[model samples]
Target: MSVAVDCSSEETADILVESQNSSLLENETEDIEEFFNVAMELAKNAGKVVRSAFSEKKNINTKLTGQDLVTETDQAVEKMLISSLKERFPTHSFIGEESVSAGKKCELTDNPTWIIDPIDGTNNFVHGNPCIAISIGLAVKKELLIGIVYNPIQERLYSAKKGQGAYCNNEEVTVSGQTELENALIYSEFGAHRDPEKLEIKFGNMYNIIMNGHGIRAQGSAALDMCGIACGEADAYVEYGIHVWDIAAGILIACEAGGIIMDPDTGGKVDLMSRRILCASSRSLANQLKNQVTPQSFPSD
Candidate 1:
């Protein structure tokens, strides 16, 4: 006896569609993997520049204010990264802190763009502090895809890929899993803006955290602070007046490590250019921190 099987035309079309979708997904994965490898290598090379200048007396320059310092190492590293990345990805967009400060427009289009801070903790780097990071993040249509922050001095490397868990030194990491504010180890900074009025508001926010949390720590480096959240060293991090480059990589790494990010003001979705951030190990903690924060006004970055 012969058995006959009939397949409907619609079923065939559906199968074809599924296959096409799978192919597209595979291509996207491969593309991102390539981008990630390039980014990681660039971060290591940038670290070399930072390490070389760590012990040397540096040529320091002020950007917006005297406290907002930028060293020659910062410029050299940024130039090296931009030059190398442009060669590899000529069509992609770029936003570097030094470049933007030098008047390059900070625009995020739908194109793949690399957001970079050659040296995240410039003040710390200037003062011989090792809490600095070479931060690099890639975004497509404002969707973060990869984040890599390497603190060469401390030999700590934090990284993440979209939909993939965060890692520190090749080992997966996670948030501290503390929902209550009292149990949270909070990280914050006064930021580079020292306007007396702004400082007054910032201090008020700090006081709130100091009174409510287990402890408040100030690292002067937003990237490293966020990494602390990822690796369970800190439970919450809130800051205002930080540029997108400062937290671009850190944000993804923290979120990938089972963290939550929100706007400190409205507690809504984060706006990267808003110059504000609040992140925690859990949504409950994030909401608590959000309520405790009193944000100051600053022009969008």
Candidate 2:
């Protein structure tokens, strides 16, 4: 989490000076690029921390539920990330998973904020899997301006700025063109919420997807799953009990890659902190997945 960005205050001042131009949209774009550069720097540093910790003996513990585990690497990486970012952008708000797990509440406002998941797939990392990533996102004025998801183990980096195209390993990427659920590859990250009724609904959704979709992947990392969809590696993703820091970066990356982040309930807006998500390579596939697994059709609302 000690990624280095040699940007000085003078550069930031220059960016501010440029952002005060006549066109608001252009100014916003410049701001997004500026913050995106910072986020990418932090993400790369976090990736280094994660990779270094992968083979070491980590102190693991549970949170909220036994299924929800946290490692010392998670804590250390988050601390390093927040401290590094604070050194660069002292006024920016930070909402990190480790901080929230340590009893701090995270509330997003219309200010420049950084939402970070130091090690997105802690379980996978614990289990010696390489599907983990460092997720970092910047939101300005309540709008997501930059998204960065870096899988250090796989050496894959996915990033996007608002109104800019998404990229994977420096190459532009897009969502899969598959529009039908029957021909799509779907991924789901089941959180630690294991209520009986919810489990029933989740299993039902899995069954339907298994029967209809070409394949289904159960990954422990929501950010990497979203990157999969962004690069057309996976056609869709559906998960519940996810938090803002979990999918904030992924949402921007997916949307920029032509994927759809849909609300199963109203088929309208998808809130970043909604705790529910159904993403697809296309709107049609997203709607189709929503029809199959929306909670309203089951016991819970």
Candidate 3:
């Protein structure tokens, strides 16, 4: 269950190999192993807190809009995570969705930071659906380095470390190798809040997929949707109006699992904070999906 990768330069290969071999039996020197262990533990603990408050009557507040919600459990779990992480790494930055909503601008710093969504898919949680999850990710200088998404309902854990493969419940996972759109099952989200004209264009693109591809699904949870793609449960997922915390962890896992992600609007590599996303098993399918939806046709108004 432990892996050692040589990312050193040719000149340093001898030293790196010696270091690797020497540390093979040691515990503290392995950053990936340490990160995986801590993340998995913290996520499971947070999941326990979330589950405890799931069915009970708790204070829920709307933020940004009525559709966006936060519950007492979110704050409680975030506080729990922050306290635990701070205890372990006091100098590291921390950003949580609820913490930011409270006016804490925890910017990504050069120092290691933890980006957390204590309970993603809060709307689903409020409605008693079990699709919600706890998303925890570690980023260094704004680049995702480690990710862990835990669904307490299913007791499933999806995790990844940069340059190391992704895993679901300790089993290595990879995106489907489906290269053609016609053989791929895609997942997407469609809603009424978006511009009608823009929606029409997206719908048209989706219609093409429905007719030509294997099928389409809208799972309602962005984190789960990406994880589904990461584990090859689905071939691709595209959506808009999602924030960094919603997709940050899942995106890293998807990419580490061999999936490709791009901005749906520009067909460029996705910025982690970008609101729009198009994730697919292969570059060709992603481009095929992108070509079907033209940004020019989408109204700017």
Weakest ten-residue segment in model 1 by summed lDDT: 1-10
lDDT of each: 0.84, 0.78, 0.75
Better of 1 and 2 by TM-score: 1
Itemize residue pairs with steric clashes in candidate 1. none
Superposing all C-alpha atoms, what RMSD in Å does each candidate have to the true structure?
9.7, 8.0, 6.7
**Candidate 3: misplaced stretches above 4 Å?**
1-29, 191-205, 294-301
Model 3 lDDT tens row, 112-190:
7788899988888888889889999886645567889999987889998766788999999988867788889999776
**Pairs clashing within candidate 2:** none
Candidate 2, residues 1-301, lDDT tens digits: the string is 1110111222222112122322334545656666778778878888888999898888899997888889989998889888988998888998999998898878777678899998888888988899898999887655666889999999999998765778998999988867899998899866776678878778888889989888889888999898899899999998877888888889888877877776666566565666777778776787888887846232111
What TM-score number comes out for model 1? Answer: 0.91
Candidate 1, lDDT over the whole model = 0.84
lDDT agreement of model 2 with the native? 0.78
Q: Which stretches of model 2 miss by more than 4 angstroms?
A: 1-25, 296-301
**TM-score: model 2 vs. ground truth:** 0.88
Top candidate, metric TM-score:
1
lDDT of 1 by residue, 65-170 (tens): 8899999999999999989999999999999999999999998766888999999999999999999999999877566778999999999999998667899999
Root-mean-square deviation of Cα positions for candidate 2 versus the true structure, in angstroms: 8.0
Candidate 3: pairs in clash: none
